[model samples]
Target: MSALQLQSAAGLLLLPALAWALGGFRRGVAPRVIATALALQLGLAAALLNIPPLRAAFALIGDGVNALATATKAGTALVFGYLGGAPLPFEEPFPGASFILFFQALPLVLVVGALSAVLYHWGVLPAIVRGMARLLRALLGLGGATGFGVAANVFVGMVEAPLMIRAWLARLTRSELFVVMTAGLATISGNTLVVYALVIAPVVPDAAGQLLTASLVSAPAAILAALLMIPPAPGEAATEGEEGIPTGLYDSSMDALVRGTQDGLGLLLGIMASLIVFVAIVALVNLALEPLTGLTLQKVMGWALWPVAWAMGVPAAEAATVGASLGVKMVVNEFVSYLDLARSGGAGLSDRSRLILTYALCGFTNLGSVGIMVGGMTAMCPERRHDIVRLGLPALVSGTIACCMTGAVVGVLTPP
Candidate 1:
């Protein structure tokens, strides 16, 4: 094995150690749970990435998902015309200037969201989620609600994942709640995967499939991190009921489509508003900091995080750049980090570094998302709001570590 690959293998071990050392209740950490989670995480990554058949299947599914983005362009063009990738009536001063994210890319959430809802209503998505939940429960010995929530996060947003078990949120143990939150932060939702895949498509091969695999593999890592940070007290592990996942409420296929579209619209608006606010905040902060410190926010963060990136098997020359992207993901959001990744492209990065960061940055672990998680959980179970707030930062830590773990695994498995 190459030195870089060896470093990645070391990273797979070091990240969990970091989580354990940072754990709030060290004595309460359950070794059995931790061991199981680690084994499951490593095994899953190997099977999915090493085995040719599984890799091909995932690649095919990823291609199908990517195709969804293409189909969305058709709908977008009908509504948004030239701004949405349709041919412009007249030539512009600059090529590609007509492209508009609001018109061309964001509309994809609507299509994927609508399709996901329809599938859930038809029992397709629910069945798959339920099966995964069952397997997770059996392997990790998690509570039913916890497993359901984590599995649901693979296909839905953090807020939506807990919606399936909202009634039980107040009943979930502290460890389970942390797991749910961490999983949400670790995995990207299906509806938004298209947007991310599109952003990194220029640099990352099989972007859609890699994103999908990253989400799937990150769940166990998140669970591992959560367990280390806050293992359940004896007898508190199964506090919630074992009723399993609840049924969908959509009245029919058409109702599912309509409701999903509405949800997508809300998400689209939220994304736009958040981006505007956060980007402006970053710009203002950078402007202030640059004159005083001779450094921007990204640069400062890069300095702090480059060691972590290097430990994750990034080459020394590229680690600072990759670390900067990670800092952007944590402080601002993944979308901006990915846009930066796209901008840097081959000029500033190697293929392996791009692949590693693709997994690392494929998450919702930014500060903004912490607020979203807290508020959404608070709304669902007002009485448990304090617990939700208390666990928020720890969840962010666990989730961020989880993403790094996934990247490390990819680094180890991929050829140098």
Candidate 2:
């Protein structure tokens, strides 16, 4: 392998090394487990991106996401009329065509949420999550409940996943609690993935698969980070699951439809509110920054994450630009970061840089997410609220590191 190629694979260890250092070289059985997880995730990512059959199978994710959006729009047009219909002819079109990201794209989050609930109610999702959770438990030596929550994050999201194992949250040790939060932050939810796929289809092929792969890889990546930063002490393990994941939260499919749409409505409102507040704040920051640094908020964020991108073997010249997306993912949210990336597609970035950025920016580790995580965990097990607060920073750090670890794997991958 060339020097850069070697560096790419070697770079996978950087986040773990950083975590170890942060852990004060804590002694635990985690090294083997974490390394095993990283290796597995990297192998899967490489195969998915390069091996012809695997790549072809995973490519179905993009088509599925597109079909999903198209289907959802059809429903919207039936219910919402021209408000949700195709754009009308314009007398003078802008250089870049404009449409409402909220109405046109974000409504898919509701469809996804409702569909997920229906599938889970029908026992389809639980069967899959349960099987995957057992596999993770066997691989990572995680206690049943922790493994279950981690696996569930792939489907429901950070906020809802913990609800699956709520009965045992209070029994988990501080370090184990750290794992739950870290895993939650490390992965993006299915609903958010759909919204993101809708936004970035312009630039990336297999957007859904890449995002899904990131979440899959990052679960163990987050575990690795947590293990290093706060290795479970002797006798410290998550409590075994005492109950199956709750089901029948709704009476019928129609009820599930109502509940899911209600959940999505709340999320849609929250997303809009957050966007308005954050965008205004970023604009203000840029106004002040423009005079002193001749850079905007996004550029500053890029500068902050440049080291991570460089470490991942992104071309040095483009490192800062890609890093800015990481900065946005961490500071704001993945949704905004993705929007920024789509706006700057291939802006002098090589394929390697783009691939790394896609993996790196796929997660729910923004500052705003901390409150939601804490609140959700607290609601599940109120007594652990203090522990959640105490461990929040480390969890956040581990989550960010986890995403970067996945990015490193993508960077090292030999694409077909």
Candidate 3:
């Protein structure tokens, strides 16, 4: 293999490398599970991204995303009337000359959240979490709370994942706590799944599956990374599958619906506000840097992260272009990086680069999230506040490494 190709394969173990560097890496720590997960990710990526039968099965997820968006419009249209939808009473389009974030993406998140709550109350969601948790704990040798948190993160938000194990937070060791944080940041929540799908469905045919697949593959990546970074204290036996959404969280079915809507509103506001501020800050930075070296924020990001992208087996000519997405995902957020990738319009990008970028930018691993994790955990478990602060930077690093590992798997498996 070429040097870059070898580097791409090595990058698949990037998270382990970081964990080793940080100490606490046992020579015989779940080695079978680690190797299996890596192989599974690469094999899964090749199947979904290449094999006809598997691709068809996963592509249905994208179709479902499209259908859900349409369904969301109907819910919005009924409640919001004219303003919520496209057509107006007579004169102009309801949303006016252009699409609206409030009318579109936010409403989708709101509806998804409500549906999620309803599912939870019906005992459906917990059943799924328990099943995944059992499988992970068995295969990965994880403690109860950590296994559940890792599994729950795939379906819920990062902050909400720990809510699944509310009672265990204060008592969790630093190693266990870091796993919670890393897992949360390593995967995307189900609510944003549709929002992100909307951005790339046009360019990538199986957008939903690609996004979901990214999270699935990263779960093991995050687990192994956390284990290597901070070995759990000996004899640390966490609670069993009951580590899920707190009992009595919703009084009635209707109450669950209302609570979900409220939660979604908070998320909608945060996502919209973050995008506005981050985009503006990038513009400001580019303006300031333009005078000195003619380097915009994007160009600087490309140059800085080019090595990572190249190591992921991107074409030498287009490594910077792909690297820019990685840099943005780390510094800002995945939402911005995905938008940047969509803006790239996939011009001159090989299939491998596109697939790697898609997997890499599918998480919440930026610096801002460190504060979010710390603040959220503190509110839930005030006693462990000190531990959260201490593990913030390492959690961020671990999450970033996990996402890169998935991308590297895709790169290494694809033909050069």
TM-score (all chains, Cα) for each model: 0.96, 0.94, 0.89
In candidate 2, stretches whose alpha carbon ends up further than 4 angstroms from where it belongs are 78-83, 87-89, 92-96, 292-296
Q: How high is the CA lDDT of each candidate model?
A: 0.86, 0.81, 0.78
After superposing candidate 3 on the true structure, give the runs of residues whose Cα lies further than 4 Å from its correct spot.
Answer: 1-7, 22-30, 43-54, 75-85, 88-97, 233-245
Tell me which residue pairs clash in candidate 1. none
> Candidate 3's residue-wise lDDT over 30-102, tens digit each?
5686777676677667777778887787768877887889998888778777667756767755422445667
Q: Which candidate should be chosen as best, given TM-score against the real structure?
A: 1
* By TM-score: ranked, best first: 1, 2, 3
lDDT of 1 by residue, 101-192 (tens): 78888888888888888998999988888888888888888888899899999989999998889988988988889999999999999978
| Steric collisions counted per model | 0, 1, 0
Model 2 TM-score is 0.94
Score residue 166 of candidate 3 by CA lDDT: 81
Q: Which model, 2 or 3, shows the larger TM-score? A: 2
Kindly indicate the candidate among 1 and 2 with the higher lDDT: 1
- C-alpha lDDT of candidate 3 relative to the true structure: 0.78
